[model samples]
Target: MRSNFRVALIAGSIVLSQVFAVTASAAPSAHPERSSLVEDIRFKVEKFQLDNGLTVILHEDHSAPIYSYHQWFRVGPRHEDPRRTGLAHFFEHLMFKGTDKYPGKKWERIIQANGGSNNAFTSRDYTGYYEDMPSGTLELIIDIESDRMRNLNMKQDEIDSEREVVKEERRFRVENSIIGAMYEALFSTVFKVHNYRWPVIGSMTHLNATKREEFKAFYDQFYAPNNSVVVVVGAFDSGDAKKWIKKYYGDYKKSEIPAETSKKEPVQRGQRSVTLRRAVQSPTVMVGFQAPKAGHDDAYAFDLLSNILSNGNSSRLYNRLVYREQRATSISSWAYTAQEAGIFNITSELKPGQDVDRSLMSIYGEVYKLRNGLVSEAELEKAKNQVMTDTVNQLRTVSGKARALAAAEIIYGDYSAVFTDLDKYNKVTREQIQNVAKSYLKPEQRSVIRMLPKE
Candidate 1:
């Protein structure tokens, strides 16, 4: 799925693990930076479960005459067996294929006629579907969503068609793109046991060979009401909304959703590197190291460090590699906080004639500075501001609000954490940033992928 919104990863795990099984009804903690502002901004959330095991989280916003209806399934690439992959991504496409009642193109048309826009995304942690529609169309959306969930007509032809689309997607997003190819290689090299090493889109062989029965079996097992959370944010009448939900989804049966526990990767003892010779204008390298899941305290430290390293030309890596030294044309870093242990990535495209080894050494040299000494107070403050800005921007729309609520519930394992994100980041000390850099960014814990220009 192509969309105007969203990119990559399952939300990295942290502060609250899935064991907590959070209900969104709790009050949010105050924002110390501005108590009045945090106190004034609150979401009146209603969290409940239906008899059939459907979990619903509602955030009632009456300022607008529309609602963001999002359903998040706990199934993702991490849930699949090694032999069978990409089924989760397949269902993202399959969900819209429709049941006998609505069937084929009719499903999208109804939403379009109602002045709504809809899209879905699949990640390593979970799969989600959403529709942003006028509040008046709540019942209709509910009825149709229920219909497709219980009565999806899975067909061989449709599966075959979608398979080709997925294969092409792999080509476009992975094989043909330099950054994507490097990441695919980086993750696979870094993770040996965890499915996080397995790309969210899955292996090409699995996509080409997966059968209809296998797809249906996966759907029956994982696509249950018990395995998902439905979020309705924006303007909607909660009273009427609950009624429509029950009328449509009340009687649906819950399936025995499988436990998604997979093997965690064993610790890496030494650096692992993959080198590629490709036809390109410039050589590039992507180095990845293990970082904490979102639930860990260090996850926040990793986030702040990502900013300090590469947020702008003023940051460490950019200032050293791109601007000051002029060893590379570009440089950046990301601390991916997936549900399981995450990855900290630093990628730089070398100046056409620059030395790859030197470029890599320079990248590591700046990281050494962070480990050797604490970042300045100014650097830390700028990182927090950048992070806080990104968080606020995500909530600029009702759809973004629903997405955040869904991620908080499913990805963070606690919806209330969404409210305290600023508090968490603000609490991260410079020492913590240095400590995480020392702990996780060791060369032994790293996996590097270098792409060289072909002869």
Candidate 2:
């Protein structure tokens, strides 16, 4: 089963630049220049919307006989009420339980019979479902997806069974796992008011208390044509795909979009700390600071700063703490951006008997240097290049392109933001990185969590 915990964790901090281009044959362009490649991608992408507020994006690539279909809903853990946390994530699993027309097991059986695979995941900001199948099965996929949008049939028994599954998932992912427990503690400490303080998997207490009627209410409110975007990529005719979408999804009525939460997290006045004693062999340290939201101006600089600090073997954290100082077995940093403000976290696993305080101080020393404008032009360029290369590599697959487009539309409001944001990274200067470091990474604004082995 796909879980939102990992997706939200990774997407929250990572700024994946959606960049690249492949020819109609899905082969790399022969020119090998960035400008030419970007233009090629711009030419291939097509987007349109239906009358009922359903947005559709299509990218035609006849290189392979396969394609990926994705439906992204703009609701996730962030949209859930604090009293009923994890409802959005619960629906991620519940969506597959089937509708009246299809019935249980029928959805998965039909897809597998057609040589296709389908799965979905939830995150803080969105929940998405996708299927990878041969080009011939596009209509079938559309038919099944559209039917379930307004017709999901959830009985009490199925709801109770899936509630147990989600509870077990929370046990395995958050309660039992040390790192998972640590992350939960860190977020709870970091944001006192924001719904993001809770894990997307939710708490067992809330999961158990949630009723069938509550689930239906959530489904009716957020799962509407207006709140969704359908993205189709790979080998398909755009005109035919549009016609199929109209036939399947055109008549679904749009529901009232929920008003966003107005609660704001108050600024942290002093450092907050937590310690967890779990069954583990090694100790770990995670230091997190509140940062700007996704698509915020400061977010781009923080993304580049995260890369410079710990992206590779040559990064400051890796070379100083993990290699040269030998205080840590591993060290890394991430800037998780969301619809609301996010966290910029640095995590380290220390070698046996290493001093956690000393290691944390060393990490702080590096961040302080960045705040002092110590980053060099070459270092900035190298980090940008690393991000660019990683972005291009991820976009190489059809599934990856589909995901990028969906994320762009969901998180940034325009599918073109995926391409335009590449320039934001390219334009980030050393001064901007230092300024963000100073503004956001202050010690008093940080939340520190240490997980130690229970003796």
Candidate 3:
């Protein structure tokens, strides 16, 4: 289970009109009768920095006697050397290989024995490991997490074992899966030089080439107090939790992460497309349009545009393609904003005999409508409501709260931006949505990947 992960294409970000973060639980649910989701969401977080530079954020939720511990690092595929490629994700595998104190699966066993669950995920922008356990075990979590952060003992045998595990993960996810392969290809075709061109799971060749020393050096540089954020949400004495955090995480010296340097992906000049054949039952297609980074004035509009096109069966693309024409088995879209450039993506699994070019035409037909015509007031309002509802759901749980907060801090560097999200979406005029579609969704700016059954 640890070998598997889901790519955070959205980078735990754009939670823009998406409204994600350390939020939710205000004294009164914003008067449902009232307008303004902006005022509707809120959170109280206490933040402190350790002497060693570990930033801690605590949100006390006494509603349940449980807490979610999320440790986020400013390290992921984005920080990886193009040659070393998967090193960021490689550590995701290594981190769990265990420290001398909790060697092997004992670390997982200890947590499970204590009635808690733990897992981790890698993304284009960052890596996050989390544990959800009863608040009673807070100190236990801190002690063990801190221990592994500094004392992980990685031997060549362990590294080799984990490498093989990730290699299989890539095979299963990218090499074998149709939708998976299309998504991976979409990034590569869309960017010429950006690190985003690579899969978060990474390529098998680089995984094989990366050695133990490279892994050790990466761990030493990225897994430091100065490079990570610790967020705890749920029932716990904020004061006691702070003390435990200092005792467990303090003392470790910060590492000197070299100044990050990566060439900006050169501007994409024209439409790009790739056709890949796979042993699949149905043809699949994905289209990606280069868009702005998260926190861009335009990111929110792109997100709303995505929702308007794919939020449900009634969405424009779904209504036109699936419900009406039956060209696709299913359809979806995303405006994935990240620390770097973002992509506005549309994906569809087509009927067995659907013509790929015809499918592309049908999909573009729906998109061009938004570019040429403004969405109805009612339709635009519905998209805003859906975006708000999703954001509210993101705020409903402590884990959701941590992700939103951590994303805001790490991706945008301002936790408070979370509070303004609903208003951001609310203020997006219909014209802004249409204008963004016209500006970013041009054919020259698009990259398409289509997968067909092995013939």
Ten-residue stretch with the least lDDT total in model 1: 13-22
| Tens digit per residue, CA lDDT, model 1, 1-455 | 00111233432322221111122232233233553334334567888889988889988887889899998899888899788888898889999899999986998888888899988888777898999999788888888887877788998898889889888998999899898889889889988888888877888999988988999899988888888898999888889889988888888899988776678778788999999888998999998888777667888788778778887778888888888889888887777777777788888999888899988998888878888899998888776666665555556568767877788788766787667766777778889889988998887888889999987
| CA displacement after TM-score superposition, residue 418 of candidate 2 (Å) | 1.2
Query: Which residue runs of candidate 1 sit more than 4 Å off their true CA positions?
Result: 1-40
The RMSD of every model to the true structure, in order and in angstroms, is 5.0, 4.0, 3.8
Residues forming the 10-long window of minimal summed lDDT in candidate 3: 1-10
- Candidate 1 clash pair list: 12-294, 12-337, 12-338, 13-293, 13-294, 13-295, 14-294, 14-295, 15-295
Query: Residue 271, candidate 2: how far off, in angstroms?
Result: 0.7
lDDT of 2 at 42: 52
lDDT of 2 at 78: 79
What is residue 73's positional error in candidate 2, in angstroms? 0.8
Candidate 2 residues 1-455, lDDT tens each? 00123354333223273323312334332221344334433536888889999999999878899999999898988788888888998998889988988875988999989899888888788899999999898998899999888899988999999998999999998889877898889889999988788878888889999988999999998899999999999999888899999999999999998899837889898999999998778889999989888788888888789878987798899999988999999887777777777888888999888888999999999988888866877777676666666556656678878888888888877878666656666667778888999899898999999999887
TM-score of 3: 0.93
Clash list (residue pairs), candidate 2: 12-336, 12-337, 13-335, 13-336
Instruction: Tell me which of candidates 1 and 2 scores higher on lDDT.
Output: 2
TM-score of each: 0.92, 0.92, 0.93
What C-alpha lDDT do the candidate models reach, one value each?
A: 0.78, 0.81, 0.79
